[model samples]
Target: MFRRFVAIVAFVALAAALTLVAWPQLLGLQRAPVLALAVSFRGAAAAAALAVAVVLTAVGLVLHRLRRGLGVLALLLVAFAAAEAGVLVVRGVGAPDVPVAQADDVTVLSWNTLGDSVPAQVVARAAAENRATVVALPETTEGRARQVADLLARQGSTYTVFSRSQQAGIPARSTSVLVSTALGRYREVTADGDTVGVPSVVLDPAGGQNAPRIVAVHTTAPYDLDPATWRSDLRWVAARCSERNVLIAGDFNATIDHLDGLGPAPGRLRTCRDAALATGNAAVGTWPTSMPALIGTPIDHVLATPNWRFTGFRVLSDDDAAGSDHRPVLARLRPAG
Candidate 1:
């Protein structure tokens, strides 16, 4: 009787743990260590669940006495897997076709060049091809940005560059932004402070009247094993997004899941909404070109204040061999009025 009681307790504990793993937010443990990592890669988590289910089924076939218990555990895993898949489906999976830019439409492209791994010419061509007026590059130096601007100018596309760096030597500490001359001149204004560790660029139009505030973001990656710094960077970015009429782009080092409670509003960090999510492309990942979009994590993004509406968003994967592990994300927006 004591053995049976212990078994029941163990079963209950296992089910509870799995349930929390599948949905960490249930207990506000989404940001906890193992749970945070698990949610970051839902596809992998789901696959793991199914794999364990298969093993459980094999064990059940050989061990009759424990067969029922194992079978129950296997079913639980399968259910968790299905639930994760259902979430992905609900968030979205397919990429939408990019819309042609209108005269007043603003085309923003965000790409982490992996510390200038991609050539300036390639970056220029990408912007021109997409008719991007604003480009945010994380882990890119001012020198590389100038090269891109010069290349664009030689090709009849004029751009003004703004850049910031936490320190010299480390390319990851730098970030660059390019705003087309067509949109008027913009000046770098993040002199006082920046993200917790990674450098981020803040820009304001020359007149600073009736223009959108722009931020080129590069938050510390969680893999640095510095959760505090990572979370602080996210919070700082969120504060910037609170104001109206803002445009933000770059490597956030976080997924929408990780942004919960960090935002001022539900589904928004401050008032900024993720363009990919608004356009139904949130499920498509943007990092680790080695993995399929469905399996990898979406750490890159473009977000805008409520004043702007997202017409289209997509993660560009054709340049898989482009030297950078990240795939470029493009978001097209127009004033909401």
Candidate 2:
């Protein structure tokens, strides 16, 4: 019976496809083509699979001859949705309240300004409110960076600001950093290497103040840039983590799922560990304010070398109306030593 053979083949193919979507790392396809895109938004994928299952179940009830096979496929889809949802729950969809910065603690804030669509004043206010000692602004230009520094200074928080761009005077091409003088003065410096599509700001401590090297990151999104370029940018961001005593933060454009095998244990990048995962909110997404926090992509992050310990971390979704498509991420850390 050709019909029976066709049904068997269809079932096998659908199962295989769902398996890859459920866990691409099963085939090491997490970083590969379609799988990479599918895994980027686990919550969304689960919702999609569940919707399809519901539709299939309705159709199966109406068409008697196809009922059995359709019901089986529907069941398989429900299983896939459950599997994906389970991962999010395990990763944690909500973060608990984090303590505010105290003496000897450094608070870091990262916000992609969407090429300055979000004003400098809003960014300054968030930084001040968080008592952030270091701020990373991706998709923000030099001019806006200076404005943020000035606003913070007026609020009695003086910072040394540095920004870099793939091209001069282009907001979307730039990334910026502001380091509080509380830590010590810092200066803009060359990265060990370069990102292919956008700029990331790197800083070195002046006079060896024991301040960690910092990178304000901005790797291009995988869907927006060519695969090679996206991979190249991620590599550059990872390389930034390889140095000792470093603080890296901002829109990395890739999740821990994609970063697997690119680093060591509990590691999100090289020797650095993700603050969100360590603090139990790794599943809370930061991008696409249009999407729910639990359903969007958590491509933004704050990560640090082994020498630092995360005291607290959270993704701020309350600012979804703040003009940027991205939600800001905040983290507090203190020296392990």
Candidate 3:
């Protein structure tokens, strides 16, 4: 009876661990009471597993001399499982770097111009006012992208880079990069696959001087429910920015823990938060121009590379802006060691 009880407990513990890994989304959907309990003791899952391993090992040694080897093996398995669980905890509690700018500091702004009669003007106004060195406009038609680019250029812009299409794989949806005259001109890198469902622009800021490489992208929406899609988009971005001092900015439909009511799950794949945290930069939330009832689901973002530094950031929601459903966000940062 004692051995049977131990076996049952061991099975339950092992099953729980697998469930956490396979259905994290489901875990996020739990009710408040249970959810709080689950999150408050997330380590319990791993601890239970370890405890089972130790118990089973002890039982093996006590029950039969022939099982002594199995007992040792069980102990080793416990150690391995504990280590894996610890690594995930570390990953969740991310420790991102926060570097300082050297000399080539650049400011960037990214917004999803909801198009036509939305709030494009407000975003544009903010960008102009902020004097952002790099700007990314996702979900933009080629014609409108040119229109905005031209408007900014009239103010004496030097370089504007954008795809003529709105589709990602084919380089549509018009991801544009407009640089000030001081930054000089750059060559556009050819985009390869449908990996990034949105058109992304890569800017090599190397104007005889070492400027940080900037890639601007817009990701697929409803990203919270779609890991495969989100992963594909991120991998595409990673591929595009495989090298150099990189800074990625755009309407990445996600948010950080800085906002309340948002959860562990929402915070995990939040493109903006993850990107900024991964690169060790501070970011401001930008989204929901209509300011829906939630008022807290920040879905847009700007993220810098690990070597880059974040000085400041903000969101613009002036009623004067037009052409989008999202507020524009401006960020200032510099490259570091």
TM for every model, in the order presented, reads 0.94, 0.96, 0.57
lDDT of 2 by residue, 254-331 (tens): 887888877875347899899988888888899899999888989998999989999889898777898999999999
| Greater-TM-score candidate between 1 and 3 | 1
Against the true structure, whose TM-score is highest?
A: 2
> Which candidate model has the greater lDDT, 2 or 3?
2
The list of candidate 2 runs beyond 4 A from truth reads 224-226
Model 1: runs farther than 4 Å from truth?
A: 224-226, 264-266
Which lDDT value does model 3 have at 244?
Answer: 44
User: Model 3, residue 327: what's the lDDT?
Assistant: 65
Q: Which ten residues in a row have the lowest lDDT in candidate 2?
A: 220-229
lDDT of 1 by residue, 54-92 (tens): 999999999998899899889889988998888777777
Q: What lDDT does model 2 reach?
A: 0.87
Give RMSD to native, each candidate.
Answer: 1.8, 1.5, 12.3
State model 1's lDDT. 0.86
**Regions of candidate 3 where Cα sits further than 4 Å from its true position:** 1-103, 116-123, 164-172, 191-196, 205-208, 223-227, 239-241, 256-285, 292-294, 319-321
Quality of model 3 by C-alpha lDDT: 0.53
Tens-digit lDDT track of model 3 for 1-337:
9986886677567556555442334545321223222332233445665777777777886889637555654655575456535533443332233233244777777777764344445545666777777777766665655666667777775446555355544323556555555667565556555334556666665456566666667765433433456445654654554454566777655334221123233333222223433433223224455543122234566765446656655555554246566766666776555
Clashing pairs in 1: none
